[model samples]
Target: MAKAFASAGDLTEKKISFTEVGEGLYAFTAEGDPNSGVIIGDDSVMIVEAQATPRLANKVIECVRSVTDKPISHVVLTHYHAVRVLGASAFGANQIIMSDAARSMVMERGQEDWDSEFQRFPRLFEGHESIPGLTYPTTTFSDSMTVFLGSRRVDIKQIGRAHTAGDSVVWVPDQQTMFTGDIVEYHSACYCGDGHYEEWGATLDAVKSYDPQSIAPGRGDALVGREMVDAAIANTRDFVDSTYNAVKPVAARGGSLKDAWDAVREACDPKFADYAIYEHCLPFNVARAYDEARGIAHPRIWTAQLDLDMWEALQG
Candidate 1:
């Protein structure tokens, strides 16, 4: 397993990095952590995903301030993961936008997910006490919604599900750029704990359909150029396929989760040895893949106990 999680004990507090992908589009990324995007318009700015807490979100706000002082009018949630959505309040956006499916996930598992994520990733929740409560969207849509930043247009759509049931992407056609939340990752690991491996490839394909010149993924460095974009999507797809295919046969034979995990580890550790968080995410990834291979359509909710139990069972 790669040593991505080995540095978990050394993680510093949230810090933001702003990379300009276009004239007004900036990709705000943290250190191998959840990312938020900024789109500056003539009169206002729109933030993509909110961080995990107000403290974290404020860092993104600070970066935005460096470029322009436009009021943050809208905060768009790419999905309903607690680490991504709970920080909405810090932005003080007049309108919090999300897909209809995302709103449903918030209502269904928001609290449980919030608890589960906090327990698994303590560092990301720097000031957990500062969080007011669960975040709910003020505006939601089923398929697509368009918001204009004065003359600039930002399109939000629930293209398809991959990482979770409510995964969405922010596409700026004019800039030929896309902000894909967990739908794509570069260098960093793809957290498949709540992912649908079968549909993940298709989701990547959908994102590629836009032919984005640049893409800010959920984590890692922002991708530039069509070649880089395709490579990133392919890397994410291969990661999912390798894990699922490696574990499926073992699962079909009624092998134990441990046995399946071992098989997947041996198969993937060679090819994906350099990817970030490979070790940190392998156990959870294997568990979900094993379950899916056995016909479990929906990913089982992860709790703290489940996390520790799986870690010990597979990594012990």
Candidate 2:
């Protein structure tokens, strides 16, 4: 039988865990769902990724309130995916930040992404109606910028393109902890629908160079040691390599998208079958990889209808 479209069938709520990866640093993880990072400075706080909606963002707020009452002063969005940015309004942060490239994506395809993802993962958007509109960053930097929460320093930098063109990693130099947005996932699948497969490994290498003692990844558990942090980075690299390498040959041979899908499934399933969102991400990953293999450097925007069409073509 065909699989349920995207994550539509994944309605069961996951257990939420608020893990402290470092001193005053927390990772808000809900099983393998999208995770958010909390960095507590000497005075206020900085949030890594906003949840999908205001209701969901409130959950993160609750976790933040439990630990410290420092006002959430800044929100740094790692990329422009709707699930990551739409909840910006709830933070009431004075500064909502993103990379310049990420802001361009928000202007280019934010609404399409919102519509597409809402139809794809209903559970994430529990309070979709509450999202004010497309989220735009109040401040954008080209490469790197540092923000100070009182005496604490948080560095936000656009290391390289991996998950999205404007991927940013939040670095707390004092703790040697990094909040790597979708660029590095633990056991969860990397949604390559808007990814740069060729550039992703290099970006991972840059992330590795930091030698973070702790890493709050995009999904899965909060990594608290060099051993676990290295493991997650290696696993994420393998997942990207496996998916792209599988599709490249198919596209090189002038095969169909279905052929690429089958190739990717054969290459990835044995290793990543148990990964969270693996099924939901497979078709889109294969589709993008196929396009990239055929010399498409930039990924095409995904609309709600394109999602259904591609799913039907691949899994129907």
Candidate 3:
């Protein structure tokens, strides 16, 4: 367990980039940090993902104010992760939107998740005291819902289950821009602690069906072209498939979590060893893969203790 949970060691600030992917669609990417998407309509603006805390979210608000003084009318929660949803209060938006399943997860494990994630990635939760509690959605949709900012339309759809059971993405038909939460990460390790692997693959295919011209992925840089979009999808699929493939057989053989860890290292090290968060994410990813491979339908809720126990058991 020598440095099993060394997430706090990564405290360096990333270089933030605010790039306009479409006419009024923008992506605020901070190296490999969590990303936020912006859409400025004729009347108001909608922020795709809220940062970890209200204080951190203000950084995004500052960037938003630099371009347009429009009131942030909507705050969209792409999923139920605390890092992504807990900062909703900062926007002071009229509506907070998320999938119904996301809301359920929040009701069930939001507090535990907040503590678990904060423990796992302290750097990401720098301003922990600023978070006001779990962010409850003002609006929840079952499958898909569309909100209009004047004549511009923003479609929010539950693109099946991948990263979580409530995985959702915001799509702009006119700009052909899609803001996928963690459903599609580019060159970043997709955290599968609470993921649904089989359903996640179909969800990625659902993302491909849109053929989006621009994609503001959950992490990493924004994908602004067809080729890059395709690459992001492919990279995400590969990460997901490789993780499950590596762990499934070991799990079927009644192997230990450490055994699954070794299989994952052998399978994913050559291809994605250098990816951001690979070291931090490997244990949790294989834990879930092991569960799913053994016919576990739903992801077991992960508490702070579970996170540490799993890491110590697998990390050597």
Give the C-alpha miss distance for residue 293 in model 2, angstroms.
0.5
C-alpha lDDT (0 to 100) for residue 222 of candidate 3: 88
CA-RMSD of model 1:
2.1
Q: Residue by residue across 201-290, what tens digits does model 2's lDDT show?
A: 999999999999999999999999999999999999999999999999889889999999989999999999999999999989999999
Q: Candidates 1 and 2: which is better by TM-score?
A: 2
| Best candidate according to TM-score | 2
What TM-score would candidate 2 get against the native? 0.99
* Prediction RMSDs, each to the true structure: 2.1, 0.6, 1.1
Best by lDDT: 2
Report clash pairs, candidate 3. Answer: none
What order do candidates take by TM-score, descending? 2, 3, 1
lDDT of each: 0.87, 0.95, 0.91
Query: Which residue runs does candidate 1 get wrong by more than 4 Å?
Result: 1-10, 13-15
Model 1 quality (TM-score): 0.95
lDDT of 3 by residue, 64-157 (tens): 8889999999999989998898888989999999999999999999999998989987888887887888899999999999999999999999
Q: Which is superior by lDDT, 1 or 2?
A: 2
